[model samples]
Target: MGISRHATAHWEGDLKTGKGRLSTPDSGLMQDTRYAFSSRFGDEKGTNPEELIAAAHAGCFTMALSAKLAEAGHPPARLDTRADVDLSMEDGPALSRIRLKLDAEVPGIDEARFQEIANDAKENCPVSKALSAVPITLEAKLKR
Candidate 1:
């Protein structure tokens, strides 16, 4: 004998004007900050999912980098990170690539070690892992 998990999907069309104008912020770069550069992910301002993903990725990477730096005895003064998620329409609107631009200020850290730590954070960050390919489980139930 086995138990079954259940879930439901819901959606309503014709909800809005569908006038979601995309905002491609002319990205400069990144590496650390807080109440400093002011990453405005709040309110969304009617942004798309791609933008949200980018914001989350950026924040996650920054935090990860901070932890890495501190662990390595070189706590960062600040970190500014920008993650650019590219949405491609060439093949039915898909996420093609993600670019992370980071500008970091760490005391008593060399370029080589900093790069290593940054790469480590990029590879090990929670968000980065989530963005990677993974298996999914699902359950569905019907409404009567």
Candidate 2:
């Protein structure tokens, strides 16, 4: 379980009135980074850490679900997962909640069984384990 990402930031002033750029490893895009309470809440085009976390969670959950399906002998023909992370200022820089949606096309599984597998995937996914402080909701659909 080894993964790495790097970002460099430069700030000239205090947190409320400062701005920075966040970039991934080898990414060419200079994303705008600032305090959420500033004038950059949902207006700036750049992404924040919560969005990145959501992306990772989505990918991780999809892979976990795929593995679960295959392990159950009903491998999915296709699986699409999307995760939405909401950020709030209750305590600190923490994820308020996460919503996950999964659409899959697999053979030889009923909706109930598919849902069971999806629940298992959600509980066992790595990202989910890492984000145990946040509540996650799942909506799974089986394509007929």
| Number of the top-ranking candidate, with lDDT as the measure | 2
- Report per-prediction Cα RMSD to one decimal: 15.7, 3.0
Instruction: At residue 41, give the lDDT of candidate 2.
Output: 51
Q: How do the residues 21-43 of candidate 1 rate in per-residue lDDT, one tens digit apiece?
A: 23333342221111111122233
TM-scores of the models, in the order given: 0.64, 0.80
Alpha-carbon runs more than 4 Å astray in model 2: 1-12, 26-40, 91-93
Runs of candidate 1 exceeding 4 Å displacement: 1-12, 15-45, 133-144
Ten contiguous residues minimizing lDDT sum, candidate 2: 31-40
